[model samples]
Target chain A: MTAPFKGYLRADGRKGIRNVVAVAYLVECAHHVARQIVQKSDDMDVHLIGFPGCYPNDYAFKVMSAVTTHPNVGGVLLISLGCESFNRERLKSAIEASGRPCEVLVIQNSGGTLSTIQKGREAVERLKAIAAETPVVDMDVSELVIGTICGGSDGTSGITANPAVGRAFDWFGAQGAACVFEETGELVGCETIMASRAITPELGAALEACVQKAEAYYTVMGYGSFAPGNAEGGLTTQEEKSMGAYSKSGAAPICGILQPGDIPPTGGLYLLDVVPDGEPRFGFPNISDNAEIVELIACGSHVTLFTTGRGSVVGSAISPVIKVCANPDTYRKLSEDMDIDAGKIMEGRATLDAVGQEIIDSVLATAAGQRTKSEAMGHQEFILTYKAFDPLGPACLPLKRA
Target chain B: MPEALILLHPTDNVLVCRETIAPGTVATIDGEAVTITQPIEVGHKVARVDLRPGDKILKYGAPIGSMTKDTPRGGHVHMHNMQSDYIPSHTRNASGGAA
Candidate 1:
């Protein structure tokens, strides 16, 4: 079988489904000006993402580096409030080292906020022109990294979209694509079952331990990752949600356990341990769905499959999000926002295999340059904040095992 | 007949309501007819058999939680009578949440 998509070939020889010029604000003080620059550029490919704090955090630097250097990013414009300590110079050098056109503008050094926005806008315009020069290359399914996340899930989600995505993940795995599923907080109850899928006994133990970390972390914060609306949508407990979420992995062997920004050395299904290593310092594992998706993109995911039951209308900035609706009822109310109707499985109008194939078809189409509903609607929502982690221990990456 | 309630997994002790079942609606379970004791919304769970307090609630063939109070078969099973066996869940999980 041959790969069906032609992707943007990057200078590093990696391929990307989207070529985006990231306009990132180093601090909250520069966010408005960066937003203005992206707005003035009037390009769908110019995306906004930023960290709001002024603190110098190793974790933040790592995440920002991974995100800016992501294969999907063709060029970057760094907007900084000169007083902040986010280290814009290092980031600018990183982008330049990778051969992408990069420019850094400090609100204080660029002649204040207004002139900076004007300068940033011109930078984006120049970046767009430079980004168009990326070579087109035929990328195999093996070269693609895809990720899945379920949000606003309800009772029907597990039985429908989640499992369908699992099936799709299975197909991708068989074809040698790297697949990622994340949010350890939501997988608390399924650790035992999830561990059993690991490629080696040691990796299985590592998988179980990460879920334990998430369970303990959320417990200290006074809430499980299970949300209130989950109850309203007929989800009664965390384990049940975990079971449903577990289906998104399909039946693939757990190839590796990765932390945020850790790339998979090869193809197969990998579980991203989003829960911070060590004790809970931050309030929650992931503040929002986009936060998780951003981590997946940083790990080199070209497209994301987002399964929603209660109807999440979110899309990411660097990668296109294919919203798969799991509830027939929710799909009816938000048809325009959804890309696939896995909910038909509940209605008995469609089978899981059909929807699974539909998801795969959607992925290939999106990879081949057709815009997703969210991308066409201009939903480049992105956010990055602070969190720390110890590097993945030997068992987590397990090169010998995979 | 309204779309019959479903048993998500063979070992599950809870029936997922595929459609809303009004109070007193007689539903079949394990070849036995059980009358619904309360109004249950779609996506909610119903006791597949007589449930006693301390009984582990099963769904998708896994233990989701445990009963906090005794309830007859076909009775609505939710947060009031059932609680998470794991950590305390967010109490206000409603329509509004971060995307």
Candidate 2:
């Protein structure tokens, strides 16, 4: 078992790896003001996040509520372009209910852009002050919620960094931590194998159905999640990439399925079904890596493990992302940006077990307040786009012992 | 020292290049010496045996894609010779932008 670390205790009794004051814009028109507030604050802990849609969306509202109340979040400052349709009042109420300091500034009522930005900055300072007053408490691995995602993937990702992350996930899950692995669209061909690892037969069927939804959604969109960077880095097909991405889930028996804003009921392995439930209306399930990270944060992931072969340099707004480089060449090129080099396994300098242990150590250290490379370089990238998802079915979340 | 190629699974018909291999670089495959015919970058695959069009290309002991063209042993097995059984992979040429 891992030793307990000093974690920020939230009002709801959840523990956070980081204490962040989020500046959220209800609409795109207010995004500039929110950005200015965060930029002027000169505090890395104050991050910029928002839904850029003018129309109301249940999915967006749910994700925003979950994120604002996330364990990692200490407080929230809302920026609203007064006439937009986003329910800023309801969002503020949700934050207040979570006992976090929350303030809303309307662009129109607050005298427009310059004034809103000024007020937003002041609100951020107050939130940050309130966040700093959060009590520090000893938190265990069982209290942590960790997420894993792969970006800029290549063929090397499967054999090295990805499987290494899987091993780490297995370890963390065994230790009673909620370990989530996502990108159902990427799990196209491995549905059978993935389902076989589910704890119950009913949950297994749900797993297969979710992957089918992802396949159907991607088919309608006329493109799988496979990208040019993936091919350029030697990944040939979406299924091949799926097989690679699937390895990040490890061999842990998946306890349940979770949608974007659904928190896992207990600590164990979880498969986050990121694809929308209905016929494909939105362009892609997740626009970019950060979108998935945001969803993971919304689901209460305290820290996220990011594996890459071609390499990506993105972190999240509230949670810190630990980049595990798969290919030795990519690691050498982007060493400064990576947290763990699982590529060392490919180079014969380290074994998968060694690299996996290194990843766990890094997670423990990160939870203990060590700054990740992305965090140090100030890469708190966040994005929340419009999407629709139905509530999970009964079988989606099998009862797991807490 | 790192080997030129690494076989991921016993049933896999493709061996992944451990490093950027140059033409004429010799590698042992299935206990037989085969010389690389083209420059294969790390993470890319090379044919373990002669492959014909429509043959399922196995990697990590499962079919990842199928061969669209014949490839000799030690020849590169990638986008040029293989195609996905499900979705067609998009590149910069098709999307007209970096992905």
Query: Best candidate per TM-score, number?
Result: 2
Task: Please write out the lDDT profile of model 1 over residues B28-92, one tens digit for every residue.
Answer: 88888888878887678889888999999888888888999999888888888888888855665
* Cα RMSD for predicted model 1: 2.5
Runs off by more than 4 Å, candidate 2: A400-402, B97-99
True contacts kept of 2: 0.70
Q: What value of lDDT does candidate 2 attain over all alpha carbons? A: 0.91
lDDT (10s digit) by residue, model 2, range A1-402: 567999888888888988999999999999899999999999988899999999889999999999999999999999998999999999999999998999999999999889888888888888888999999999998999999999999989999999999999999999999999999999998899899998889999999999999988998888899989999888999999999999999888899999998888999999999999887777899999999999998899999999999989998889999999999999999999999998888888999899999999999999999999999999989889989998788888887443
Q: What is the lDDT, from 0 to 100, of the residue B49 in candidate 2?
A: 96
**What DockQ number belongs to candidate 2?**
0.77
- Report model 2's interface C-alpha RMSD after superposition on the true interface residues: 0.9
Question: lDDT scores for all predictions?
Answer: 0.88, 0.91
